[model samples]
Target: MSEMCPCGALLGESLMPREMAEEGIFSNLLEILMSASSEIEQACKDSNESVDLDTCLLLTAECFRCLRNACVECAKNQHVMRNLGLISTSVHLIKLLHGIQMKEELLLTALRCSLQFLGNIAAGNRDSQNSIWKCAFPDLFLTCLTYNDEKIVAYCCMILFTCLNSEKVRELLDPGNLTVAFHVLKVYKEQLESEWSFLIVTDHLLKCPELVKALYAKLSNQERVTLLELIMVNVNEKNPVTSEEVNVLMTHADFLAGCFQENCEAVLKLTSAADAEDEEALVTIRLLDVLCEMTSNNGQIEHLQSLPGLLETAIDTLRLTHIAGKQAVNIFTATHAMTGQEEISHPAVGFKSHLIRLIGNLCYKNKKNQDKVYELDGIPLILDNCSIDDNNPFVNQWAVYAIRNLTEHNERNQELIAQMEEKGLADNSALESMGLEIEKRDDKLILRSVRKKPS
Candidate 1:
């Protein structure tokens, strides 16, 4: 034991896990781990020999590590350990150590090792996950989450994330337990190693409609902000973005949009710069992004538009940002003149882009929304937003998209744009600057990129 061989690391990183399991090594390690605490207690009782007790504890910890390594990529070994009852033994060992009045380093190491082994075995083994989860839910996991040790907390999160399933999600949704679950998720959110653990769990919970409504009803405003941010990240990071995924968010679009409506008003009233940092403003920005994602789906867009004043509020927020000169000062104070009283500060940058993006998404292929924008005089405002702003990256592109949608197949909207040009009310400078121009091609106004000039 003086020098643990590096190749020992390769013990569980086995390509021949089935063959290794057949060798009966996992059973032997399980025996060592199960008998460890008893062996140490026997050593202490027979004689006050610290070395003997220490050796027994250390050997047990090693057994935990070896079992963890063995189960890493080997489902067979994970099944073997679960069948051999390592789950209950590890749980008992942890409870025993934690109950000790005098905290010891070896005891802590053993507890951490037990947690790590459990997490490893639960990774993708649904049976093992269900077993450990049964022992952990409502109490053990909550206690682990409160621990000060970062490694212990992270391991606990890892296990929770691995074992999370529909049944556990229902238990987690329990009113008494939901808050604790959110607390654990918040803890996981802060840990660098396990940050995605929060997202994974939140994503799963979000898929449950009951959990979604409960979350909204029970979560405080700040917790709601975090939940919204996690939902945004989860949806955005999904590859090949599926319809089922979009549908989950859409199912709760109205609830989320109601949040957007309330927070949008609070954020838009930011007369002083410091108000931008308030929780309302923070939630507003996240809601904007989340709503933007929701509106991207055609299935969700009509429902979002159908929400009373939702479309109007989006346009109004954009108009107010422009009227207040919020977008310009946020990007650059020197480039655009800002009157002291009219200037507005936002909680974070990219607020305008997300806002514009939501408006654009709401208008996508919906003539009623297209007409609504025209009625609210949002066409010129959106056209004005086509100008590039450093704080709101892609605001220009989103604005162009909005204008395109606003005028598509709608003669009234199209003629209004033509009339804006007649009155010089439209700012085509932003579009022209990007080597694009709006022209009437076959009675349909087309915003086409100029081929002669590079865009």
Candidate 2:
């Protein structure tokens, strides 16, 4: 007899973790699924929505029981499941029971597993993602959402939200029919996973003016802050701020300034009322971050400058964070993707850099604010980041820019940098990158990043 092929068991086990396969779970699961296929097929042919449903339900329940294990998700790939002709049946069952559940017991037993099957399959498999997108429409998901079952609704959310990061899957996200996702958020915002899906769904909804304004009013203060932050950061660069939908937040100076001031006050309150690393502090920092980005316009800049002490308050908060720098840096290195991993900017580094940039903007050609920053003892903080810090990779780059901006046309600030340069304290690497040049004019020393050529 010909040798038996090892591909079937090997491919199935490839989906499972090594430890799981060692315990024989993959082989055991395959045996259980294969043993019931004939029964499942026969019962499906015999049963209707009403008559003779028990045998089909029982076989499906057993399959669901097996699929509920963690390894089942790994085995959902077409290449893996095609080993035993299981993928086709699974796909058919998912489509057949898209919105039809016989009873609470039956729904819990079979339908939930089917939805989760589709979801898990789509997670990292582009082909499955494409197929699920083609099969599972907004109307089917709307029906799932409208049902009273939380687990079922959560599964639908999972399945739909799985591939949103993919450009191909984003095409399947119809912005007009996003009420299904909104319904999940409206009902399950407190659930952490649902909030993630909600963010993904509404990210695509930024161009839809009516939904965004309505969502702004519907969500709570904290939720509003969180959602707006997500929207601001993740909107497609090609389409960013193009429509009236997202433009209101970008253009309305009064409201944007209010958000900035309110979040500042909140962060200040957090200093006394809560721990520095608390959730409230994080939220305040994020909102302040959004406001910092919004201050690009002349109108917004005027409103921002009018808020006395807000800029100083932001500087002080950065100083407070500096106190816990060692601990925070340790935490970041342990959790964040490190250098040589990829060229992606570390979030912790970006947050600090953005704060520095905001300070730079505040002091940009605004001599009075430069005086204010100097009075607030911001020079040392800027200088601390001037040298290459092990924890914060981009600090020197932004610090150089901030220092260049702060010292622009200001003799006292220029003197401070000249002293640092004399003492070997300023970042030479940063200066070199900026193309720094120093000039001796009459008796005073002048430092500039880019030299003006004969103009």
C-alpha lDDT of all candidate models, in order: 0.70, 0.56
Q: Enumerate clash totals for all models, in the order shown.
A: 0, 0
Worst 10 residues of 2 by lDDT: 1-10
Please write out the lDDT profile of model 1 over residues 263-369, one tens digit for every residue. 68666545456465677666777788888886776555677777788888888887776666654443322122344345334455666677777877777788888
Q: lDDT tens digits, residues 164-238, model 2?
A: 544533343456555654665554455555654564545545544445555655566666666656555543232
Q: What's the CA RMSD for each of the models?
A: 5.9, 13.3
What TM-score would candidate 1 get against the native? 0.77
Off by over 4 Å in 1: 1-56, 66-84, 101-104, 195-199, 216-223, 239-246, 297-308, 326-346, 384-394, 427-455
Which residue runs of candidate 2 sit more than 4 Å off their true CA positions? 1-226, 234-247, 250-278, 292-310, 326-349, 364-368, 419-434, 450-455
